[model samples]
Target: MSEYDKVRVGRLVLKGEKLKTKKRKHKKQGRDEEGTTVRDEDASAHGGWWKTVRIEEITGSIGIEFGNQTYVKALDNGLFTLGAPHSEGEGPAPEEILTAIKVNDTKIALKSGYGKYLRVGPDGVVTGRSDAVGAMEQWEPVFQDGKLALLGCNGCFMSVAQDDDSVVAVSKTAGKDEIMQIRSSTARENENVKELPAEEQGSLAQVEENYVRKFQKFQDKKLRINTQSRSGLQKAREEGNLHEILLDRRSKMKSDRYCK
Candidate 1:
């Protein structure tokens, strides 16, 4: 079957005790090589929720918000199996709740009590499990109809959500350090976009320093000229030669003795 075959894409929710699928029928077609009709159970039989929408992650986690409440989780690692071993005396272990469920031989999280977290779909078969996820903090999954959804969390950093054909692990720890690593590594790539080589970027600083040095040279020369002009005026006044000097220049006269 094609990757998208029998896939129920999108979110499903419970509104006032009624479950609703968020997707409209986009298309319809005859059965494929297999005689599987496009029934809700067909999707559930393939490990997908018959009622819940299947949200695929392209870049980040798929988020869903309804009626001012939001649900979020990783779409990748899903509830794989049931009746697996569970962690004993680990949770809100009231006689009402189950402690934990065994996931891949590890007792992580699970729903307890009437097994309501063991959600069922149109066929009344459990399609996925809902439990209090760890390290994910406020992140939780809600199962309505046959689909499961992620709910809100208070403090999470650049949360990572994904979906493959199998396995889903939702947590703040997901995609951790990936964003920082990608950003830092891209700096070098951005630097390479310049016409000059990497070393030439430093040349800009050196060019600025050279301009400063040139400005200082011009300033020093100006200061020397001002000082000389002042000294010449003082000497002319003391010697009573100011008029003589002015008349000499007007009459095109030359006196090498006064040149000093």
Candidate 2:
């Protein structure tokens, strides 16, 4: 008898002959594809609260405030729109917050809540569909006088459509509608960290010794430093000629091998 017709009338199902069924993949609740929890607390940790007043402070996680009480928000469809206004004191919603990565001194890239890099399309519509940053994903924040605007890589200024509140980059020149503010949670005190040149970093005596150690040939293993007035050194440092003045001092001491 054919194997298909040989089934016993009773419960004689063969071992290992059961139907192979696929395990159902239940979608995770409140979690993105990357397994990150989509909660307001996670957005807050990414600097979603404070308002950034300066352009230099526009790094890390930030929000673009387009209009009064309205912020540029990312949508599930990978597009941006001006979100509904919130209370006067409340900050942007979780979807309105984005990660701003400084690509260079003049350009920055933004990543939306969906983990996609934002870019301007040929139609000037802003979309966040790229998985990684590219040339088109870069944006320049132009600050002039007391106003700020975002310039897209397409040479258009980002502006909100008055009809639909959609975020688009259509105008080459930034107008009143294009002005926007980027807010962040960075402390104001941390913005201006004092930086000094290597030669003038420490106390005056230490500054002198640092140069001496760097240039001194020390044939007899004895350090020789210029004990003359450090006023000229301080002046040179202020005038941005500290290196030349330090080299001259080492040359006068007959210590630096390269001074000759």
Candidate 3:
């Protein structure tokens, strides 16, 4: 099955399309080896919900979000924390990844990367790291259609509502706004974050510095005498590309010593 990930708060959300396979009218006809693709209406009649996706707490963090003095971590610890784990950016705390295991009860155990389970109590408080499994260790998966939420044994829904700032809390009411869009580490191309490579970055910075300096020294006093430079500048302004600003004349910035 194709791996799927849900969109997050700060991430761009795009419309997703799926191929719906239609049912063969004749029972004798075997299913196509290559599968088939049909219109959206045909797929709906076949009772297709596509692949079921749920809110799953992972057991490991693929990577880290670096910062100067602080970092949010806890992927493999069976508990997730959002704060500066280190006083300095040197030694980063271990990330505990989580995976959900559906035990005998309706509750599912969110197994941590270290084999521990994340559980909530009647007070809607979450904790982990126990050798034995109990009712308190199980979490009931709550779903608002595609939006996934968790209703712990505490009778409260897991939420990061603005109502509280104390790490993980389950007291949040089951509202659409409270649903957290936990994103995976799957690499995505974001235009806004698409930075130039190191070489390009340095080149761009240097070019800009050169441009500002050149403009600062610019004047129209010699416009008639230096028609070539003027025309080059004009062309540069019109084209709005490299040459428009970086004139072909390499010695454009040289001092005018007026040598015979």
Candidate 4:
């Protein structure tokens, strides 16, 4: 049996030297009810983990926290087990952190620190030995009634084993023990914001027609757009005069009511 399989969950504790806690000086002061001044600490500085409520938000590094402060930690042998309990405001350890990739809209794949993908073996043990993600490597995070549970490809819910605390997928239905939190760092800003298309960014002929329809006063209600060679317009766009050029085109067509 592997070291992870023989290890008991209760006996596990954070290994290696303790991480030094970063201290910050609060510049702002606040008055308490007793009229005493106190330093106002930023809440964001204390914790970096944010609960991932949506599957689409499960990108980048993540920590699977369950049963108090315990997390699912990746072992060197490509196996996973319940890690040591962490204090409040403490982030997960390096081995406890895993890279999460959104496989699709409903499925995701977890890559351990060992650079292996996590998948359920035939024995239902959650192991990270696969080099590539397949159907068995894809996992679905089920969220219901404000509870989160991970559903493996084998149609079993992932949970910590009671005997050894090894991560496994065996239960067909998710219960209290299956409820877990997937947390990510708060450094991701605008991660879900997609770039707008050229037409949507008002850089295409279709966008010109849309502007004309919104602001143009046509007697026949027909949309009119400049169909001539757009080489000059493209140059104007490069020179930061595209809007002026578009307005000039509208004026020549006598279609813009705002044009004087």
Q: Who is ahead in lDDT, 1 or 2?
A: 2
Which tens-of-lDDT digit does each residue in 133-210 have in candidate 1?
443222233334543434333222222223322222333332322121100001122333424322222333332233
TM match of model 4 to true structure: 0.56
Per-candidate total of colliding backbone pairs? 14, 0, 12, 0
Q: Which is better, 1 or 2, measured by TM-score? A: 2
The number of clashing residue pairs in model 1 is: 14
Tens-place lDDT per residue, model 4, 7-69, is 776534478856676799887453333332222232232256777778877889898989666
Q: Please list the Cα RMSD from the true structure of every candidate, rounded to 1 decimal place.
A: 32.9, 21.4, 24.8, 24.2
The TM-score of predicted model 1 comes to: 0.16
Give the lDDT of residue 189 in candidate 4.
58
Candidates ranked by TM-score = 4, 2, 3, 1
Give stretches of model 2 more than 4 Å off.
1-54, 190-260
- Could you give me the TM-score of model 3 versus the true structure? 0.36
Count of clashes in candidate 2? 0
Q: What are the runs in model 4 whose C-alpha is more than 4 Å off?
A: 1-46, 186-260
RMSD of 3: 24.8
Q: Give lDDT tens digits, candidate 2, residues 1-260.
A: 89978876655568888866689999866434433222345235433465555556788778898767678999999999999887655778889989999898888999999999999999999999999988999999998887889999999999999899889999999999999878776555643544454655677678879878877888698899887888887778778887888788788898797877
